[model samples]
Target: MLVAIGACYLDTILTTPYYPGEDEKLRATNVTRRRGGNCPNTLEVLQQLTSHESTDEELPLALITILPAKSSITSQQIRSAFRSRVNLDHCIYRDGFEEPASCYIIKSKSTGSRTIVNYNDLPEMSLEEFTGIANELGPKATWVHFEGRTPEMTLQFVRYLRKQFPSIQVSVEIEKPGRPGLQELAEEADVVFYAKTWAQNLGYRTAEECLREQSTRTHEASLLCCTWGQDGACALERGTEDFKHVAAYTTENFQVVDPIGAGDTFIAGMLYALNCKRKDWDLSKRLAFANRVAGMKVSQEGFKGLDRALLSFG
Candidate 1:
């Protein structure tokens, strides 16, 4: 079982032909509502890529997210949104919080960028609560992924998890730049994922440059990956400073239909590549495979058919 820790958000997405100017009135072409968040989106994509796509019994993909009260309609919607592949049996539901955290997204057709505004009144998960969930997972879990948020609490949980479950491999995503203590968290994770936003925020102009220069900041044995949209991704094996880069996959007449969750999709694909059944691939090949998966994601509307990302590789 691979356990993921993060929030469960109700995402309201609006697609417009172009980014709206300040005070401009432009009606959106489409409006969609769905269950979203880093953990859910990644696990959902991973579930789709597996051979047993309909059940978690063969390959358990579980989420440890905080949701609204179990009785709320929003919570029910979030729970029922995913297919049977993702196990939600270990969710934490707050009694007093009836409304789920919301993410309002504006996707522009012309720019291929998603502008997001988030509103969350729900209380953050405490370290104690996460420990309880970890205890429940016990010896069943093989890998645990953490979304970088509530950095202080997450940091504590990561350390605690390492001490408690020394056999379980840990992976952490460093997506947001403003969050403190992520640097420390990065040092502890076996694999660390860095978004372009996170990289660029630190004055990095390219993914390769980021890995080459920032390699010393993390632990010696940690593997670091930095994903730069369109240009593809670069990774570094920290111990040996073994760096590799893979270009973005694209076909003739390629088009980007939707960019939402592309990073999360990349994370899922990378996780699938490194931790899934196919483990003999080299660093470059793994990045290439993940690049294809993520590239395929942006070429379509949503996560459907991402399993086909393995077609050329297979």
Candidate 2:
């Protein structure tokens, strides 16, 4: 099973008509609340995509995340959402903090572009938490995936894990770059996945450029992947002949209801495809699958628009 570690947020997304003037007040047409946060979102998508044909077996995925002692969301809600697909034997429910972190996402009616206002009071998971979970789950986990929002904390956790067990493969999703002490973490990651926006945030023209710069500076992981919306994705493997480009799937006729978690869904699809050990499928194939998953996600109105059919392994 793949183990994903990171924070989980509850997202509040609003869809409304565009207002032309600053003085004009706009009315929201729709609103949605759903589970979010990079790692859980991606892991959830993976779970949906890799469901078994029969109900007898569980999906080959697990999530290790933090939750408050008492949640507005009921225990049944949590169980119904993830327990079937993910092995939560190492999960924790701690007694600190307010309601889970949440985001206020706004989508423009005219352009379909989105703006998000997020609120988070993330409590850093301690080393003891990491070691305890790792000791229990590391031996059985084939892959460890972390979303790079918590750089220092995640780096320390991953570094410790690698030192204790160098055999497991580790993948990192670099959501925000230019973070202090990030280069060291990059050097230790087995694979790095990034988006164009993160590259721009780091002052690079593109994600590929950022990856190239990292390769020049560090003797880190060999594989770098950059996901581009609509246009598709690109990958650079160390010592490989050249860079590989993956084209996005066509979505000309689909109606896009929401696009909030598309990128996370795309990453989940890629990870799922990789874990399936489909060596015959190239990077392009993976990206195509990812693009399809993302496009399908946007066609739905809420986060729960994700269903078993979208994640069909068949």
Candidate 3:
């Protein structure tokens, strides 16, 4: 089973001609509403990729996420949006709260680049609650992915998972900056994925350089990876100074309708490959496979065409 833990939000995406000027009103070329978050996006793609892998038994998936305590329209939308196979019984609903929402403005006619304005007022998963779920999933869990929310709590939870279930692979996405204990989580994770823009903000010039620097610091992780939009993705293992770069599959003949969740899709592809194939793949081949999957993602919008995208890969 692949277990994902993090925040889930209702995302409203708007496609505009160009970024608006200060206090200037503009009309959107297109609009889409969906459930989007690091964990959910990864989980959705993973589900699509692994759905038909075997016929004997179902590949189980469980998503541990936060939601509103009271059943509201947004919460209902999230519930309806999840794939039928995803187990959502473990979701924690915040008392008397509404789900957080994010708005993305994509300059579709110009650069296809996006600007995200989000409201994250929901409470984070508590350490005790996290431990409870981990204990239940100890035997059946094959992989667990986390979004770095409360860093200190996340570190403690990951450490407990390592001590209790050493065989299960643990991966963390560290896109958010300035959170305490993030480095500690990186140190404990089996795999770490960093966002290119976030890494650049920390004074790194490129994703390869970021991977090299992070590879030196992580004591536990053997694989350190990063994603660069349009520039493709790169990775380096522990004790390796050189990075293996995978070129992004071009969208030359296709339109990039929405590129919002491509990174999460890439991570999901990587995890699916690693779980099914283990170490049979080299770093570059694994990265290349993920690159292809992400390329398939951007060629379409949202997760609507994801199944077709994965099948096209076959």
Candidate 4:
């Protein structure tokens, strides 16, 4: 089993400029809405990739995300969005909160570039809340991924899991650099994943530089991965003789509808392949599979039509 921890949100996306200034507004050329956020999006991809194995296999992936607050229409939409992919047995529904977190995304019609505005209503999960569920899933989980939205809570969860199951691998996705006490968490992680942008934000010129600096300074992490959009991804393992670079796959000339969740999908594909014990040389195959899913997502209006594309990847 693999566990992902972070926020889940309802995403509203517009493909054209909705407004230029306070007085001027523009109509969108395209629009989309979907269930999004770090954990949910990543887990949805993992679930899609892992859920159809033979019954003799271990239980499929599990997620530990907070459900939307009671009585919110967004909650219903969120539940419905992931109904097919997630098991619901591992989900937690909070009673008194007013609304779930949400993201408003704007994409440039010509460039496929996007900007996001987010609103979060779910508070960080307490240690007690996580440990109860971790105890149930820990023994089964081979790997756990954490997106740094709730670093303090995530660190506590990692600590508990390490104490309970020392062998289980923990991967941390560092979305931002300035989170308080994040370095401490990075030192404890087995793998640290970051996008090229995040690596740049940390004052490193390249991913290799970032990983080398982190490995030298902390010495606790084993692996560091940096993803470069369309360029490829690179990984450096501590105590290894050299770095490994996996080039991005070439796709048939196709249009990009939305690149919003491409990175998350790529991570999911990588995790799926890794967990399934696929060859490292096949990493590009997994990335290509993810890119295909992301391409299909953009061509459509929402995240609803991905089941076929995601499952079609062998």
Residue 41 shift from truth in candidate 4, angstroms = 1.2
Return the TM-score for candidate 2, rounded to 2 decimals. 0.86
Candidate structures ordered by TM-score, highest first: 1, 3, 2, 4
Runs of candidate 2 with Cα error greater than 4 angstroms are 19-24, 52-59, 70-76, 96-98, 302-314
**Candidate 3 residue spans exceeding 4 A from truth:** 56-58, 101-108, 239-242, 308-314
Error of 3 at 85 (Å): 1.6
Instruction: Give a tens-digit lDDT track for model 3, residues 175-277.
Output: 8766667777888898999987678878888898888778877888979889988788998877565468988877568667668889899898898778764
- Position 10, candidate 4: lDDT: 80
Candidate topping lDDT: 1
Residue 311 in candidate 1 has what lDDT? 73
> In candidate 1, which residue ranges exceed 4 Å CA deviation?
52-58
Q: Which is the leading candidate under TM-score?
A: 1
Candidate 4: residue 223 lDDT (0-100): 64
lDDT of 2 by residue, 1-314 (tens): 78888777777777778633667778898787777778878877776666642444333788787765555453235545674667766766766554666777878887888887777665667888889888877578778988776687888888887888888888888766466666566777887787777777777776567767877654557667777766667777766625777665445686766777777887787776576635656665665576667767778764454544344523
Against the reference, the lDDT scores of all candidates come to 0.85, 0.71, 0.81, 0.71
Q: Residue-wise lDDT of candidate 4 within 1-314, one digit each (tens)?
A: 77787778888888784344557677887777778887788777667656655566543666778876646676677777765556556667778875887799878776668878998767667888888888877577788888876677788888898899998889888767577767777878887777777777778886667777888755667667677766666667677735766555445675666677766776776676567645443544654555556556545554554657645666
- Superposed by TM-score, candidate 2 places the C-alpha of residue 249 at a distance from the truth, in angstroms, of 2.3
Let me know the TM-score candidate 4 reaches against the reference structure: 0.85
Tell me the TM-score of each prediction against the true structure: 0.95, 0.86, 0.92, 0.85
